[model samples]
Target: MKQINTLLESNYQSHPAFNFGPNSWAVSTERLAAFNEVYAAAQQLSPTLDADSRASIRQDLEHALNDIFTAFEAQSTDVYEARFLFELKNACVRLMGEELAWYAGQPRSRFVNLTNKRTRQDTVRLQRDRHFFGRLPEAAAAELRNLAESALGPCRANAAVGRLRREDLSVNSGRTVHALRNVLNREFKSLGVLDAVSAYTGRKTRVTGLALELSVPQATWWKNAIAGLERPPRTLYAHVDETIACPKSIVYLSDVTEQNGPTSCYPGAYEAMQLNPLQEIIGRIVGTVGSQADSPLKEYYAKQYHQSVNSENFRRHFMRLPKCLRFNSHIGWDVLPGSELENELAASEIKMTGPAGTFIAFDGARLLHRGGLMQEGERVALQVIFSDSTFTERAVNKLKRML
Candidate 1:
């Protein structure tokens, strides 16, 4: 175990994609030798140990294996690593059997309670609903509305969707908007929204302010046409931004209504998607498929699935997705709508509609959500993505300084 740890420590690099990093070719070469040595040693030592000692050792090994499994779960793996890890995991499963299953079945720890009263209350509601809505302070809201109007007013006149780059802002207005963004960031942090996001993700949080998004009535023409033809358009379906936890916020710069294509989400869907056993199994399958190269079905699988859909074996595993997850298929990740699944969760969907001051914060990765299906009036909003990655944090900080 010490040698194995040393090997992994020397080879591994912290990365969002590959657990062992892109340059560590040694992992593929050395993995089999390490695994075989460990397996042989465990077999030889088992008969000499007492039942209690054996149980303790088994538990420790399971923990170690689960740690490796979880790390691999969060990232992509090459074919060699995937095949070896899969085989090793199966070998451990055979040896540990029901005990391993029982251990892995334990629930994760609950979130720590926040200290501030308002923050605590908001956190509680966010945990329950997987989303929270509030109004920005009137002064701040007014400033934000003014900024959006100045930045996006011309965009509304165009038939196509449009965006105004930060570089395009007048010097004085850019400084004003930048100051306001900083203020809003601090306010969100103080309100405990950032803290709740961190808790949900189990990592430090960073906010990236996106370009103002302007959606006009013309943007929904194709969607309306599809509906008129009795087909469900992609915009009407709910999909996740990621399969993992990623919280985000939206500030309405213009009044948003049901007809204006307000963002919609299903409360409690965040936890449901994460905890579903079927979803977990499918996630593993997708990971395995993604690792392989030159497979006949690779292209088809890649085309059919996105971050939300859990499996690469789409035709087989898709129908087996939990009822809560069926709505994702309708979002066109699977290229077709699952009407039955959509109907099952339709009653619980909440459309975020409010005046220009409305602020909506949600776990976008796990929640079934969709936006920008405007029907009548033009819609303008500012979106902020909250992530737990150091890369995004650094990039945002650099952008801030430049602005």
Candidate 2:
């Protein structure tokens, strides 16, 4: 692993835009190389395995993709991660073809529990309570499912649709997501989450992006076999929006049963940094796509709006934190710290699981969170990321026709 201090001393002048200081802001070469070794072993798996055995192996590959995403979200650091994800995804397609690969990639259907370190005895009872799904009003779940289906159908026709997997979706896509936007807004307002969001960011926030996620089921054999591999869970990482001052919201659109994928987040992680020093060091870091104005998509948008566009815009508009909070010798902002944060994380962490209308509003730049791997049935949710007026205004104007 390249230490941030060494990286700063060597490359800081040449790559000023390089995010240094925060552990979450820098990539660990050691970790990346380790995952590469695992991928190599995965590539050599036997082809004669049964259906269930194949699914188990593919689940490990899925974690590999998630780890890559956690490493770097900036365009500059994306080539390797992108290549890694493609090869893993292709490995799945090669193993079981596209349809099953897609199924295995869904949130809840994972045959393994790779969220945290555990012994064989630790995960012996990874089953969902049947009653959990029944807790949600069936009518509401049905309504949301209809909305999700309708919302997803048109998006499938989009040029970018293939990029979306069961656990992820592209939010900025316009027309295809309009109805979902309306439905989600109404539901979130009803739940009082938008009010909490406004309070959090101290701004009249608007949804800047929307995504519909689905988590599906897996067979017992698949789960047991994969769990037997005993790979440690991916390290937790947060998605931070440097460009936006507002938080994000995700509303469950289906019964997020225990077996289905739920969101795992570290509560008070933001506040913890207010006191601890060790809490600020020693974790892999990455920037979020929203913060990259120089990115091709953002540049295209800037050109369409007849505005000056460059990577500098990203720094000027988003990265200019107050001097004390900027990446420096003592502290950094928007980072997910290392092991020191784990105990507090254990005490404060929240795993969100609920009925269709369940919702959570959080500071995207402050909180650390990850989408959970599912153990069973479909878990679907709609994510809406809110932001400051400037970014929201751009999104509004750009998505206006579709709305």
Candidate 3:
């Protein structure tokens, strides 16, 4: 908080006409006044903005925008910081969008269940921290600064808010959350983590990461620090085929303990899903010792058939590449440079295991993962949301309501 005050104070000093509009150029006075209003508004909108980063962005925008205004007074409408701030703001908006979806996806009445919402919401939130947080591209800065217009909604005020305060949206079903996803995805692509998740999961998508990603940081301080994100992460949400559109999904990370279980994958099984047949299977290793189906058939199967009849369903598994892929963990935060970054990807897909805090980035389409049932203690995981569609109010209603 002190930092933002200090930066704003310093920025004011840079603008000679900030306080004493007593008689400087019209542009200088106008820009300084406008900046001050925004600076003050941010303080009111988010008290936590007093941190060092808020200060940096505030000062950067103040100076950058003012400088652009000065040299191009006639074109004062063109603002530089507008682009950068918008990108950052858009990230926040995405966070809010997923949160809103979490609540809306539930039945209007069931949506009232805070615990249920939180679980699903927490799952998506985890994914945002694992993948999208802290990773920003330089392009957004240019786009917001030059491409954006002054009418752009204030990151803090978010004109959609009108005069309604943050408290106004606190309830289970309120206008506050309903509109958040629209503003977020429409503004920042990356903030929509749920949208990304939906693109990955073909079933009824329940993108956990997108849940409250934008607003959680504001409500909880520890989150922003954990995500290692000062600004918003980029939008990597993608899609597969039409039959299998990634819906919403829960994202999380965990370690291997016999009890905690592990992220399960069917090694090299994607082909079966494509084939969708009745014969093959991937994960299940034919039950040899037990039932009539196996026992009575085992004799006939062994005597009459050299090979066992495997269902295509069993064949549906994630590919395990020779080196890059390993069981349990597909990618590691330490060794992994990025997707296909292990260059020797021609090999089959495998899970790369790691310790706590190890981020596993993967191609969701190719990899099939299941949250294992723990045997010992509770499992710890960092989950994310993946979605393909924009989180509309209608979709949000379907989420919590369906299952």
lDDT of each: 0.51, 0.42, 0.29
Cα lDDT tens digits for candidate 1, 116-203: 7766667667667777887777677777777556656445544443332322321223654566567667767766777666665545
lDDT of 1: 0.51
lDDT of 3 at 389: 35
- Give the TM-score ranking, best first: 1, 2, 3
Relative to the unseen true structure, what is the C-alpha lDDT of residue 235 in candidate 1, on a scale of 0 to 100? 34
Model 2: residues with Cα > 4 Å off, grouped in runs: 1-142, 151-176, 216-244, 274-344, 388-403
What is the C-alpha lDDT profile of model 2 across 1-403, one tens digit per residue? Answer: 1223332223222333434343323445554444445444543443345668766765754565455435545422444334422332343334333323323321221222234332122222111110011122456556666856765544444424443343333344555466666655665444444444443433444565787754444311111111112332132333333322345666787667556877766544444334111112111111222224544435422321111112333333223221212232111222222223233444555678877777666555455565535666556677767644444566888899777
Can you write out model 3's per-residue Cα lDDT over 62-168, one digit (the tens) per residue?
Answer: 46444533443343222322232233233323332332233223222222122344334433543332222222134432332232222122322431454323232
Candidate whose TM-score is highest: 1
Number of clashes in every candidate structure?
A: 0, 5, 84
- Scored by lDDT, model 3 comes in at 0.29
Candidates 2 and 3 compared: the better one by TM-score is 2
| Candidate 2 lDDT trough over 10 residues, lowest sum | 125-134
- Show the lowest summed lDDT stretch of 10 residues, model 3: 314-323
lDDT of 3 at 284: 20
